[model samples]
Every structure is written in structure tokens, then in C-alpha cells.
Target: MHFLLSMFPSSIHPHLHPHPHPTTFCCRNAVLEDLLEGGTPKPLKTGTTIAGVVFKSGVVLGADTRATSSEVVANKTCTKIHHITPNIYCCGAGTAADTQKTTDLLSSNLSIFSLNSGRKPRVLMAVNILQDMLYRYRGQIGAHLILGGVDCTGHHLYTVGPHGSMSKVPYLAMGSGDLAALGILEDRFKPDMELEEAQLLVRDSIHAGIMSDLGSGNNIDMCVITAQGVEYIRPYQESEYSDQRRRKYKHHPGTTGVLEEEVVPLKLEVVEETVQRMDTL
Candidate 1:
């Protein structure tokens, strides 16, 4: 809750010293005009993509790890989604450094709330506060954020970004893959859908993004927030669909698992080797 801790000595970076304007401007609460005068970063050629959907049980969000520089994917295992609170989570796709810093800011704000209120604020309240904070810093480089969480009241999902804009929806997508993913979501989402159905909707949206968005691919990381708490579902490539894709195109192995699953089967080769080695011992 106590923010602005002196984590390190305030020493100017060697590279930043030359570009004093950008550093000084950002360090202070400069107006948006001063920030945007610098020009927007080219809509990142590469980043992550995220989709969120609401269901009766709660809400679900999914994202993929595919970092691109212009048109080519540079890293296949970048994490686009992260847990911000025990019951709340955020998935994002945008400038990596910006996203991380923004998320950290939000996390600190939430901690402050817990300290001030003596109770966890609801998801919608947190989203509103976060959106306002981002808006206040509108001149600073922005990040696209999709937030999801579950509380005794119900489920919540929202998208926030540019100029402090925020929209709550049954579903939403962001990043280069947003267009394709939105199309998939439009066709599949239904009001009052069940948890399983919602999961499928988000999953398909993520897959469609991977196919269409050059900056998004590799594997998907999903999170489910319900009455129980926040549960993460990682990209699983051991299923029939994964096997089929493996036969057709190569997939980076590291992108295959993010969420801990209910029943992960041990590889037969590894099991056999373990048993044989145990017998010898």
C-alpha cells in the first residue's frame, strides 16, 4: 500500500541521459499533450492477445505467447496474462515494458485499497479505479488491459486503455488478434452461457487470433475466476487437437503448458524409464 518505495537509488540511466525530454516528462505528472507530442509508438508489430468471457459460474480469460518485432515472432514463450490478486487477474497485449509497469501500478493500487478498506474491493470497483488511474496518466504511453474476476456477487469482465477508456462486456478481445478473435466471439458467445461453454468460446477466440494475428501464437494461457477463487488453465498441447497440430506444423514445446491441469498424464517413455531404473536400484 505504501507506494513509491525507494527500491533503488534514483540514478539516471546512461542511455536515458541523452533523451532527457522523454525521461523527465515521464517522471513527472505531465499533461497528455506533452506525452503524445512524442508520437505514439507504432502499434507494436508484435505483442500478446487476450480474450475474456462471462458465464454463470464466473468469468474466464485467455491469452497467447508470441512476441514479434515488426512481422516476425522473436520469442514464442512470453506470458501475456498474469495474476494481479488472489481473486482477480489481468491479461494484456501491447508493449511488454509498458504492460508490466502498468500492471504493477494497478497491483499497488489494489494493495492500497485492501489497506484502506480493510476488505478486498469488488472486481468492478477495482476496474473503475484502475481505469481512472490510467486516464489520469493518459499522456503516458498506454497499455491495453482486460480484467476478470469473481466475487460472491457474480463475475466481471472489462477492457481498459487509451485515454482511460473502459468498456464492460460479456466478452472482449485486445491486441493484433483482436479483430479475428472478436469475429469468433461474435459467432459463439451467448448470454447466460455456462462455464464450460464460456471456456470454449475464449479458447476458440485465442486459436483464431493465433491463425490471423502475426504477433500472437505459440500457446494459450487461461484463467478461471469463480466463487472458489482464481484458477489458471495453461496451454495444453497433449490433447487430440494438439497431436493433430503437431503432425501438421511444429509448435514450440515451452508454449504448451501454463495452467496446471486436472489430469496431466505422464509420458510413457518417462514412466517406463523410471520403473526400469527403480527395478535396477
Candidate 2:
């Protein structure tokens, strides 16, 4: 009972047989345990696309407008970007609910820390608190956060893994669609990019994710955190992207339509004979 409780205290089982407590975790975990000991196979939850970059001025964050459940696209307008403090923002990946709960928790902690210290918390301080909390619950809290901000310490970006690992980087991309987006960032991101250029890069990266990764897409939500404050960009609508495609594939100069050439129909008798054969079969 103690061992089981330790595995997932608030989840799994808190009490063994001959006790009154009930199982609180998913039956999937039970099946997983059984499989580890020679039982069966099953599944897991997967979702989102989140990206962040540190430009010459500050940090820029963006994500796709999707929330997913296994193979299903749950919400087309779900946002993965969360603002935890006036100067700080988080790009969430993995479980949406977990990400929301963690960011809200971080916001509360930052508030308390600010009140006690009589000064705003720095980026690292906030990341430290988040990493520590993540380490405590670790696997139970299924959120990977890209924490970015402008602080007295200067502009910064950090990736806090779902399992509590933390690292500072110039830029990062995470979630199911990360691979495609990260490739774009790696190829084109520059250290001297201004806020506007950085936002473009973020949008293009998310666009790449939407094109190649099934779990990502809808609209692109973006924000830039600088010395002044967080600047919110209008979300990129899917209809706009579709318009771009239409413009790209539309008729070019000097090109004539098939109708202009006078499209000729095949014999109607041939079509009727094929339909008659199919009906007889």
C-alpha cells in the first residue's frame, strides 16, 4: 500500500484491499503496470506546438491554436501561450490542463514572492520555483514550459521539462509539432533579429509546424516581451493562409483557362454503356 501510494499519491491507489479508499488514477496505469509485468499494451495523451526565441531586444513566444486528445483534434482555437507575470510569459506543451494549472500556480507563487521580497521576482527565480515544484510532482504534472521574459537580469528563455529538467537557451520549440518548427528556427534564427523579425520567424516556424505536423494548427498566437512590456500581435488566421495559397495557385499572366480552349466531352453513349454494365453486375 505504501509503495503504491508513493507511485502516485493523489492518483493510483491510496489504500489496498480490505480498506475503504478507491483507485483514483486511470485504469490505463493499472494496465501499464500489468504490461510491465507481462500483460497488454495501450496508449497515451499527446498535443500542442510551442516556440520561443531570444532576439536582440527580448524574448518572443508563439504556438499553434490546437488542443488534442490522442488521435482526435479536440479544440481548434485552444491557446498554448500563458502569461504568468507582467514581464514573463510561458509557452505550454503536452497536456493543456496541466500547463494551465502549472502556469496559474506559478503566477500565484510569483505574487507571494513579490509581496515578501518587496521587488518583482527575476526570471531565474521564477524558473527555479517552477522547476522545484515540477520535480516534486514530476511525472504527475504533465507540462513542459518555455519560460521567457525580460528582467533586471536581462532577456532570457528557459525550457522547463515535464519531468523537471531545466535549461536556458537562445531559442526553443516543443510539443508534437516541435520537430518541424524547430527545423525552421535552427535554419533561420539570428541573434540580432529585432522584435518584428522575431515575430515573423515565430509565425513562419508555427506555419511550418501546421503544414507538416498533424497535431498543430488553426491560428498562430504570438507575443513579444521587451523592456517596455509584453506586446500582443493579432492572431494569424487560417483563412489568411488559405488566401495565400489561393493567390499562389491562381492563374498566371499569359495562361489560358481550359474553358478558353473549349473542353470537349467524351461520347455520352460510352458513359451510358459503362453505367449499364455496372447495373447488370
Candidate 3:
């Protein structure tokens, strides 16, 4: 025992020393404290629904008109469809500013390219430029877009992601409410659809998104691109949800008896004023 005590400190003697109890402090509270000091994190308000599809002779693009800031609706009628060229149009999602600036930049670049080449820019050309720009930024640009157009090659439809990923499809959808919209598109879409059928499909898809997502509402905008020409519709359809007052709950005067009535009269006092002049040298 003496030898063991001499080898190890008396306070740490194996047999005599008590094992330390596990700490009762919670690590979660510490993390919460640190987060609280920094203030509650705000939810990102980037919400939209944009989609596109290719038909027999043309392509149709659709989008919702609601812009949100957190839980607040910022713009009820904001345009998500952007013009890339006479024949090319884009429907954008994600950050509104990013999509707007990105499409604007692409439009300007395509316009300049057309001027230099003396021919209208191709859909593939626009896709390439957009993918390259987004790739260089490494997904920092929050622009999810659907590019559709009619060119000499044929009608084209492509979905572009913020990370520079691109896909060519007969139909595509993007944004917070994309799942709902895509559900409708996948169910009704068919090969070689007529122009009217394609328009209705696109409209119904957007309506589904609006009905499903609070962030996607207000109205629907569409653009049709064909070899003949382009038709840009500001509001192809209006929202079915409207504020309607069923009945007015107005009450006539003296509907309720006055518990007690009191009236006070105002008193006014008038004072006469005299003007005096002072002489100065």
C-alpha cells in the first residue's frame, strides 16, 4: 500500500479515488446560445414556378407571377419570362435578381453575336453561353432557367441549373413548386401535341403549381415560339382565387343602445390686438 501510494499521488490512489461523474451539461444549449447571439436565421425567400415544353411545331414556356421575401409576397405580378431573341424565350426561377440579370446578360450577348454573325443566334448557342457563364461562377449564380425556342435546327427545349448543369427534354419544370407542376406535365404531355393542346397543358401545369404552392400564385404568363413568329402573353390566365365578400356585416346607426351619452361643447376666447411702431435712427 505504501509503495502504491508512493508511486501515485495520494489524491489519485486507484482504490481510494472516486471515478469522475459524467458531465451533466448539455452541448445543445451551448450551440443554441451561440446561434441566438447571432440572431435567428431568416428563411430564404427565393420561390417561383417556371416550366417549358416542346410541341410538333413550336415550344411553350410558362411561369407564375408571384415573388416572395420570406413569408411576405413581394410582387404579385412579376414577369419571369425573358426574351433572349426574336425566336428564343426563357422562363427563369430562383433568385429574381440573379435570373433577371443573367437573362439580360445573355440577351445582350446573343444580340451582339447576331449582329456580328449577321444571323439570328441559335438556341444551342444561347445554352452554351449560359452554361459557361454559370459554370464559371460555380453555382454562385442562383439562376434556374428553362430555355425554349424555334430555330433552323428545330424547336428546342432545355432546362439549365445554377451549377451549370443542362438537360434537353420535351418538357421540363423548375422552382419550389416544380414537383406539382411536373406531375401535371408528365400526366398530360404527349409527343407531337397540337399548339392549342400544348398551351392548355402549360396553363394547367402552372395552375397546379399555384394551387399547390403559396409562393407560386397571382397569375400565369406564357410565351410561344414558332418558326412563323413569337407570341408573348403578359397574362395568359388569371388566378381563380379572388377576394369575394359573401355578405356585408354593416350595422345601422343606433343598432346598439347607448349606455350613456355625454356631449361637451367647445369654448372659444377672442382677444383684441394693438399694433405699435418703433422709430429707428
Q: Is candidate 2 or candidate 3 better by lDDT?
A: 3
lDDT against the true structure, each candidate: 0.73, 0.80, 0.85
Q: What lDDT tens digits, residue by residue, belong to model 3 across residues 1-281? A: 12323344344443242331122113322443464694544447677888898999999999999999888999999999998999999999988888999999999999999899999988999999999888765565679999999889999999889989999999988999899999999999999999999999999998888888888999899999999999999899988778979888999999999999899998989999999998896
**Which residue ranges in model 3 land beyond 4 Å of their true spot?**
1-43, 244-281
Tell me how candidate 3 scores on lDDT. 0.85
Cα RMSD to the true fold for all candidates = 14.5, 16.2, 17.2
How much does candidate 1 score in TM-score? Answer: 0.68
- Pairs that collide, model 1: 234-259
TM-score for model 3?
A: 0.73
Per-residue CA lDDT of candidate 1, range 63-149, in tens? Answer: 887777777767777777776778889887677766777778787888888898888768887788767666654434447889888
Q: Per-residue lDDT for 185 in model 1?
A: 95
**Candidate achieving higher TM-score, 1 or 3:** 3
Worst 10 residues of 2 by lDDT: 14-23
Clashes counted in candidate 3 amount to: 0
Off by over 4 Å in 2: 1-41, 237-281
Residue 19 shift from truth in candidate 3, angstroms = 58
